[model samples]
Target: MNKKQWQGWGPDEQAEQHYLVQPRALAGGGDVRHVSAFLRASGWRDKSKKDGPLLMESPDRTVRVAYDPCILPGGWTIHGRAGDATVEWSAHLGRQTPVEIVAGLTDALTRPRSAHAPNVWAPLQEQNWHTRFADQNYTATSPDGAAWMQYRQDADGAAMWWTGAKDEQGNGWTAHFTPNTPMHLVQAFSTELAGPDPVMRPRGRVPHSAQIRTWSVSVKPSQLSAWQQARITAARAATWARTSARSTRPRTTARPYNPAGGARTRH
Candidate 1:
């Protein structure tokens, strides 16, 4: 479809678009942890015509992962299909899955011809994605080599909210860490086609990743620090400006009832 046509399409139309992103790390097996993945998928399907991308990244966006060179998340357990599969996933947020599941999934997936990696992690969007029992802090690294987002839900089915291309600052945002980019998380995203859901769940002691991807890199250290500072300043300013704006804004009051004269009067 043309750019205009793509932009004008509705949610259902967009949903019909199937995007498959099989971004996997081709690391030789031997207990390797650190990994990265860039998932890009997009497609369109007719209503009720079960058409989905082979590698689905939440709805219509991509994500990244950074690992801490530890357990390669050798576990994966998928319950339901994408968008509703969260029974055991929510419970396992931020924590390593049991050793048994991990070993099983990895073995099955890594077999030649059956080589698969359990990337089925919870909502990486964090903001838009919904789930049951939301947690304020949860992060996971997928076997796909990307880390998950810090969502606000936990064990129960939550909600998904998708904010379009515009940022709250009214500035156009093309990447994460933009300060106002809405988190486009999937309540129960698609399943991990490979096998076990090798994701660490919430309450995990391991350090969580800053779910943001680096779109641009600076060769000079000075430039990098400046970039970081700009973002930090923007974030802080956004917070304070929002708070101050709210504090100064006048709230609308309900019109007073006039029972005696039956005439509405403004107080």
Candidate 2:
């Protein structure tokens, strides 16, 4: 829909418009819209209005996920807070970061975790990334060193951090899980980071353009996961229902229409 038409649309219709667009993917990953939808399904409440940052927060408001396309480098930031409120963890996903990758971290937050902490580095190590210790911190680097993860413990606290550089200038994405953030959640993010599948992004929006392979065609709705497709269906229904209701309202109203405002007059 054009800007004017979209502005006149109700939230449901506006959302359907987004769902209907077959977004192109870059080598880094899927659309952030999928991540937004995932958070909503996981009990997060949408706090932003239409066409603004996709901001959502947990029931307790301890966790938040914000996606703003206008943001440079990183367009998505997911955060969580610990009990005292002094410590919070965050993941800044670059615009090209795949939806599945971000969803991996968010999905982990919603599930129950065992007492034991999963090996945060195991996933990357298995992918043949190099690992080493330096200055009391454990660090792992991708074969090319462009991507790295580190775990540091100091007098202050322990934290996990990861960064993927898109260029030598250091423009890219970063994630930091501060002390008290669950290790399982970090591990889940690492696992998705290590997946062998190539993420999709639109050709024009890709970061580290020269470093990854390109696809001639964008991903179609048919290629989306069952969960994603289901969300699209729901959005479609919402938009249709709104349209249907509006169309029937005029016929059902007994009062004469007020031409000045298009409102109905009381009998």
Candidate 3:
């Protein structure tokens, strides 16, 4: 009987890795070859055969990205690290082309850095606040459920006012602070809803809207078992080295050679 093949990274190598990006498909329909090509073009190295996951990494060995070609259309995942911080985010491939999906994910991960406060909320806060918003339209709460922030949109304009306090049972108060609310208050409201350094949430585009869309912010835990983190780090470094070697090598362009050694004069 044939043996079942191992589908994941080696047991000894899984520790050092932290996923930077994880792309998923709604029902599993994406071409892995395209994913590989995209990574190579973007300066990542391909370390495995064409049939395996298109694993690659940055030239500096700080970031790694990959997707399993044999996993059907389930999705793709990219892992990256900077300093002591590690980040992972994923999205469903949906109906978009693989190039588009990968580009979007790459752009989100590689874009310029901005100065922002670190997220103080825990993962539970990040998940619970959004869930609550779906049920209650004008209510916001901290991760611990100890504080509440509420807002209401104006009936005539794109204006909102928010109040933060102990709970929802306080005396009702309203204010018209449109167009210029305090930054600290805004940050407080944002921190309560989305974690620190929030990326824009992914919502399908609005019809006929020309506004520039924002990248969704989905952060993952940085803490990992030592062995698991090491495995990922090693994989990324190895993949990067392989691709860098190929990219830096000189290419010889093939020219049609004449059978005769002598050059023929144009007739």
Candidate 2: where is the Cα deviation over 4 Å? Answer: 1-30, 69-74, 83-88, 94-96, 153-160, 168-171, 215-221, 224-227, 230-267
TM per candidate comes to 0.23, 0.64, 0.29
Worst 10 residues of 2 by lDDT: 16-25
Per-candidate Cα lDDT values, in order, are: 0.27, 0.65, 0.39
Off by over 4 Å in 3: 1-34, 86-98, 114-132, 135-267
lDDT of 1 by residue, 137-163 (tens): 344333333323333333564532211
lDDT value for candidate 2?
0.65
The best-first sequence of candidates by TM-score reads 2, 3, 1
Instruction: Decide which is better by lDDT, 2 or 3.
Output: 2
Worst 10 residues of 3 by lDDT: 19-28
Model 3 lDDT per residue over 8-65, tens place? 2334222222222121211112334444554454456567665555567765675565
* Cα-lDDT of candidate 1: 0.27
Whose TM-score is greatest here?
2
The TM-score that candidate 3 achieves is: 0.29
